[model samples]
Target: MFQKILCIILFCTSFTYAQEHLIVIGGGKRPADALNKLIELSGKEQGEILIIPWASGEQEVGFESIKKDISALSPIKVVSAPFAPLTAESKIVLLNQLKTAKGVFFTGGDQVRIMKVLEDETIFKAMHERYHHNVVFSGTSAGTAIMSEKMITGNGKLDVIDGTQVETKKGLGLLPNVIVDQHFIKRQRENRLMGLILQYPTLLGIGIDENTAVYVQNNKSAEVLGESQVLIFDAEQSKEAMKLYFLKKGDKFDLVKKKKIKI
Candidate 1:
């Protein structure tokens, strides 16, 4: 009887520890409902939730506003992270909090700011560890962009003569060799995404639109949710185009199959 009880206790403990999930929201206005859903999936309804609003111009305003907005979701507790003038001590505090957080939310702002803070090894390790243990890591807008390996930073203007351009950078690589772009369809970001794909055909380009999300599981499969579509551009099999002009919007590239299909 004691052996059976011990086995049951161990099983319960293991089950409780295996519930991590990532909710990546595309940039735009806001996504309150999606945020709540992510919280629900995290499994700990009454634990600490860390909100990082480092990406906005008025970091304080962004953080406070998000706090108020998220209040409706009624997270057990919400803590704001230090934004401007980042300090090592403050970052360590944030990392410590993240180590046992029920869920972490990255507010929309500037991806650059988010990148700067996440570059720290301690914070990165804590995040990766928590995520591996099934703690939810959620981000929106610029927050969403840095979740992947190759991050797209510039606006997707796509006109060199007109001076409109898009820039790409090395991302946190938390998601591995994946390039993530936000405000996808609303900004017609496919052109820039395709450009990146043409250069590195083996990499996966994920274009997430406003109010939508893609939940990646164990870094292998992802499921799309929300009002918009997640455009996945896979170029592993594309024969190098002589001029690279044949590719157009609405073109489909199968990530799993590594082939192109008409959208």
Candidate 2:
């Protein structure tokens, strides 16, 4: 009976990890197919998606537009959680809403804005709790930056990579052992991403191009999607200069093993 109980407990832990789903998109034209996939993973037509537009400067207008776009996906409900002054009543309301949400979507703008508003909130903790079970999470651009614990701030333009040129801050911690960079190829952000990875070799770097995305499942594997490519940098695998790999749509990769797979 003791052995059986231990086996059951381990199985349950693995099951919970397998249920975690995340979609990180590069900023540009929103990919309709990827959005639909997110909805499908979030319980499809019956899903209730919570949109957090805290990252955008124009909160009200930004959230309104986000709601309209998500609604077009035919989900049962799409709710917006604006970046507002939090109060006891407000926190309660937000937490209540989050409880029933099948998915949470973060919009694009300044990553710092989202961090400042929701970092320490009870609602953030609530979302993290739901995430482990089955709640699907999606974010774009600056919203994408917040998915990792060490988020890259899109500051200081440079054509060449050097560790000192980039800046980073604590992120939402949704994706561990990783740092994400958005608007990659279009903005010539290779150096920026390289700088961060070189400075911190322990962490893996994922650079996403505009109109492209990486759909990560269970934090173990990720697949490339959308119009462009997703770049993966593994400093540990390098012998001399840092090496990088580019994955296009339909390509699957093992996040933990750090290798491309047939999927």
Candidate 3:
């Protein structure tokens, strides 16, 4: 019995280590510190990083800006992968670019645009495989919203938090058990997030403020970083009303435990 228990423990430990790491940023001006942390996780001094500009209408502008920002941090090579419509040949070519990549970064724009380009493509499959193998995946704004299986379309208004006004679609499904909203505080989007959580109480809600971000590991915890705060709404912990908690820089949250952990 002791030997069997030991084997189970070993398997759990290995599984945790194999899980992907994600850096999700809120919209606005990109925080320098958060970008630096992302680069550090992308193997720093070595390995190449791929930037996907599918979310933006201005692909070249998005590519150059992101490339410049990432290049400013380290000497690592950052290549842009722009998909020209949907084609089998293009999918194979895009997957080939990721063969030697250590990380994948998604720039902000329209989350639906990203889904239209990447969904059911070979490139998406390759990215999912790399994520489990220690490749760092980072996204900002619409990029952050696309990290979850349930993505917010920004179709709702702040006048009220109702299900009828809001809309959600399938995302990348990298982060589980939560719905993420970007530019939370700046945009006064608390109601929208609260509405989603109330409608789907089983899932957690994360409202990330501008100029801030969260470094999420596996499905366990997220460490807050940058100049602002990240609001967490826990439906399971609420009593009669909503349960809300705010986390700032240097703060860490227990995603699965639904509590704050001091770092």
Candidate 4:
């Protein structure tokens, strides 16, 4: 009997824990296929997905818009986290929802605004902890920006490729070792991302174009999905010179290995 209990304990302890998966869209209209994919990964009718719209000026409007889009995709139970400037009482309720959420989405607006409420230590810790334990996180625009640990504020130098000219802040840290940019090709916002990559050579820079998304299911199976292209600034691979990679739909990259998968 003791041997049986010990074997069970060993099996449970040795089981591998899952890592967070990300599906971040650059600022623009999201494709239905992408929404469909999110629904599939989020466990559809089996589990709940939480959406946080603190980034938008009108949180309710933003929340409803995404909830509607997602609901149109499937019968997934979609819940909204209370908008930013959360009170202690409301935060508690939000936290409970977050805990049970199989997936989470952040609506587009100002990345700074989203970070303001998320910066609360307790709230931040809860999110960080859940992400590590495997949650599918999806977002658009500014929501995409908040996925990294060091986030670009989109407020700094626009004309030049100078590291010092860019303004940035600590982000939600869901996707570490990478700085994410939204609305890349459409906005022609390459200078800022290149500059940041030069400044933080150790970090990888991913510029996701409008309507496009880069989904990372662990670091090994990162792939681009949607209509546009995603630019990759891989300074981590070669510190001496930065190489720019333009990826379209169906392209895959190993984020940890910093290599492109030919598929």
Best by lDDT: 4
lDDT-superior candidate, 2 or 4: 4
Writing each residue's lDDT as its tens digit, candidate 3 over 54-153 gives 8898988988998898888888888888554747776776788777788888999999999887676565677788888888898899999999889998
TM-score of each: 0.78, 0.91, 0.91, 0.93
* Candidate 1 lDDT, 1-263, residue by residue in tens: 99999999999998777765777888765565566666675543577777888888887787787677667776557778767557877877776777767777888777887778777777767777887787778888888888877787775567431212567665656677677778888887777877777777777778888877777655665666667777776666663541221222233343354345444
Error of 2 at 214 (Å): 0.9
TM-score of 4: 0.93
TM-score of 2: 0.91
Q: Which one wins by lDDT: 3 or 4?
A: 4
Task: Give the alpha-carbon lDDT of every model.
Answer: 0.70, 0.84, 0.86, 0.88
Question: All predictions: root-mean-square deviation over Cα?
Answer: 5.9, 2.3, 2.9, 2.1
Instruction: For model 2, state the Cα shift of residue 114 in Å.
Output: 0.4
lDDT of 3 at 166: 82
Top candidate, metric TM-score: 4
| Clash numbers, per candidate | 2, 0, 0, 0
Instruction: Name the runs in model 3 displaced over 4 angstroms.
Output: 1-17, 237-240
Descending-lDDT candidate ranking: 4, 3, 2, 1
Worst 10 residues of 4 by lDDT: 11-20
Query: Taking the tens digit of each residue's C-alpha lDDT, what string does model 4 give over 1-263?
Result: 99999999887874566666789999788867678778887788997889999999999999999999888889999999987799989999988998899898999999999999987999999987777777788899999999999998989879998878999999997888999999999998999998889889988899999989998876456788899999999776565689888898999988877879977
